[model samples]
Target: MTWADSLRTAWAGMWSSKLRALLTMLGVIIGVAAVITLVAIGNGASQAVASRIETLGTNVLFVTPGPGTPFTTRQVAYIRDNTPVARVVVPLLNSGGQLSVGTSTLPAPVVGTTPGYQALGAIHLAAGRFLAPADITFNRDAVVLGANVSQALFGAGNPVGAHVSLLGQRFTVVGVLQPVGQGPGVSQDNSVFIPLPVAQFLLSTQNLSAVLVGASSPTAASQAQDLLTNLYTNRFGSASSVTVASEDQVLATLSATRATFTNLLAGTALISLVVGGIGIMNIMLVSVTERTREIGVRRAVGAVPEDVVLQFLLEAMVMSLTGGALGVGVGLVLVHLAPLILKTPAVFTPSAVVLAFVFSTLVGLVFGMYPAVKASHLHPIDALRHSG
Candidate 1:
């Protein structure tokens, strides 16, 4: 028989037992859908992390002290003076606090940094200005509102000159920052920025949370990181006393970690496809038994064993491919809705979809082979004489 004729026969056979065919395809459907959805979520999370790191800029270095080894302004100044490649060295202090404007209240992260903090990148203003040198020097009670904080406190009104209470202390709003969205560490959109000294006074601590360093160039960033690492290590008497990482190093580490997790999830999901293939094999074996008499009649009518094998194989592939198509639809729908439900990014990857579909087709082909060969090997006379 021609390939078209074999395919027609396969379709007829599956159509005669529609419910059974659908039941046989169920595993492939679930497997493909699961693989696509899980991979998409994993890829999305990786992309989100990468983007956040990229926003920190390649020319920047993040220096975070170990627990109980917080750096003071004097130490920060020494690093600034010593590291010639570093263009900007800004000390940062972070704390969680309640912000209130009139009766409206919301919990937000408060950042304390120098005016040089603005030079690091991802700092943009939608309305007024960022922290000024005078503000830090004078320890002004001035604050800058992040996009979400401004919205929560002032609604549609201008927040530049408004007065707000932060941790029960009244402060004047100096600026409103444009929305920077979520990132690796603290979310810029949900934070409030104040003078470093003011934060030190409010938190009643001379310690800093972190230090941000901007190098003159990407090539210089590595040198700056090494310089800072040595400085901290010598001061604290251990290499682990502080963590100094360039943005590229951080991105590479995060990418490797994310890739490992994504691969693990994909591998786990692939087991479902294998299980589904086994189910197909089981059902096909049963089909071969039930269709023994038909196979005998066909062989008696000049149909070759190869034709029988081809027909059965085609039927298995058709079922799996149909299930894969349906799975693609379901997976795409889930990818679109997942971000809303999970509150994280989920990107649809075409490569993942294609891979899943191809794998499912392969499953059908491989699992259906033995059943087809078994069906074809039956002696014609014996098959014809055998009772159902």
Candidate 2:
């Protein structure tokens, strides 16, 4: 049969058994709707998590005791002890350092941190382990190598046990952190870490150039920020140069925008999927009843009942396959447009789109089969005698 003839025959049959077609289509409608909704939501949420990982700073907070102008007015007490919102109070000092091994020496930025810095920033250890309390207690001259530092000084060789002199003091290579993949192009891997006390003595700078504070939750970040502001105002008047940051500030800025776009994606997916399923089901059932007389004619012409069944089954499958192909194109377009609409990354993997396409076809075939079989199994005389 020509393609147009097949489609016309299918459409005519579907029109003949409207209610049966509608009922059969229920499964497809629900299945497609669910697939679209669930998949969009799952993908969107996954992308959000990935973005959060990329932008999330290593031990992010604020630079308390600011360098330029009056950065903050919050007091150390509010950040350290009084506020329930703040989780970790990391006081850091930046200073010049020299990584000298054998005859080669390289300049690196030094960061002084409390123990919480490693965990809060999600630092990964490539070799050796992060500094323990013992290192801090004895003021051990141990160092951790950032990925860049390892590459620069030791090349391909392991630098875990190598000794590097920072400034004028020697620090043993206690650990080397795995690379964070140059994310955001931050030179965190090239930096050196030392205990706060050692950094203080070595850098010859006191009173914490910056303080990094963690929050109890995203919500508490702002409250902590505000409280710190007030405390700093009281302690140092307007002259205190401390910055208070809560993760909540970043989230608050993002939630409204993110939610609206996500909902739009989900809604569009649901609407299209349901519509497509209904269309397939309606077309299938109508095609089946309309072709009943043709089935009787075939049986009378010596075609077996099973042959009739297979013929109708093949027609239903054809319709499903066609609809599935169309749905695939539409779904992909939506997935790609998501990034432009949401202003975030719309990661479209071939696997996910293929899964959705296969799912749509299955939805059509399963839902269309009952009506097709009903038409094929009809008694020849009864089908031929029936009115359209």
Candidate 3:
């Protein structure tokens, strides 16, 4: 028989037993769909993390006080004065605090920072202006509202000049920050920013929470990190007194972690496909047994053993491929709806779709082989004499 004839025979055989064929394909359908959904979510999460990191810019480094010492605003000044590689150093302090306008009070993160923080942190002004140099130097009670904070305090009205009660003192709103939604490692939408000295007075703590340092360029970030590390070690008498990490270092760590997580998820999902393959093998073996007389008649009418093998193999492939197509359709729909349902990003990758389909076809080929070989090796007279 020609290839087309063999394919036609296979289709006829499967179509004649539609319910059984559909049942046999169920395993492949579920396995492929599961793999696609898991892989898409994994890729989406990794992309989201990478995008959030990119927004922080390339030349930035985050410094936090470590064991054996405490970090303060004076350390920021020292870095600015001594380190030429570090172009800008912005000291930061933050705490969970309450902001009240009128009788309404809401919990928000209060950030104490300098004017250089606006640029170093990639914060933009939606109205009025960011904290000025004068505000820091004169230790003014000026505050900037993040996007969420502004909306909560003033509704649609301009927030620039509005006063909010914080730390038991009234602070004038100098600016409203543009909206930056939830990010991978930071959330600034509901924060309140004040001058470093103002925070020191109100919170009564001189210790800084973190220091943000911006190198002149990406090439200088490593040198700046090393310089700041050495300075902190010399002053505090130990290398563990300060922790410094550039954006590249942080991104590398995040990427490695994300990749490992994705691989684990995809690998686990693949187990279903293996189980599905075994199911297909079991069903095909049963099919060979039931079709014994049919095969005998075909062989008696000049059909070769190769023809029988080809027919059975084609039937298995057709079932798996059909299931794969159905699974792709289902997976794409789920991936599109995942962001709305799960409230997380879901990225559809064509490569993943193609890989899933190919894997399904391979499963069919491997599992169908044993049954096809068994059917082909049967003696014609023996098969014809078997009970129908």
Q: Write the per-residue lDDT of candidate 3 for residues 1-388, one digit (tens) a residue.
A: 9999999998998899999888888888877887888888997777654542445577899787875467777888777887788878888886656799998887676888889987776788899999999998999999998898898879879978888999898899999989877666334666788998999889898898778889878778988888888877787888777878887776787778887977787777677777878888898899999999989999999999999999998888888888888888888888888877886667777877887799889988998888998999999999999897
- Give lDDT tens digits, candidate 1, residues 183-245: 653457778899999999989999987788898887798888888888878888998788898
Query: Candidate 3 clashing pairs?
Result: none
Ranking by TM-score: 1, 3, 2
- Residue-level lDDT of model 2, residues 19-125, one tens digit each, is 66555554444444344434565455544432322333533566456455432213345467777767776666655456788888765667776566775665788
Residue ranges of candidate 2 with Cα displaced over 4 Å: 1-59, 67-78, 183-185, 246-388
Among all windows of 10 consecutive residues in model 2, the one with the lowest summed lDDT is: 49-58
Could you estimate the TM-score for every candidate?
0.68, 0.46, 0.64
1 or 3, which is superior by TM-score?
A: 1
CA lDDT scores, all candidates in order: 0.84, 0.62, 0.83
Model 1 misplaced regions, further than 4 Å: 55-58, 64-116, 121-127, 131-211, 216-224, 230-242
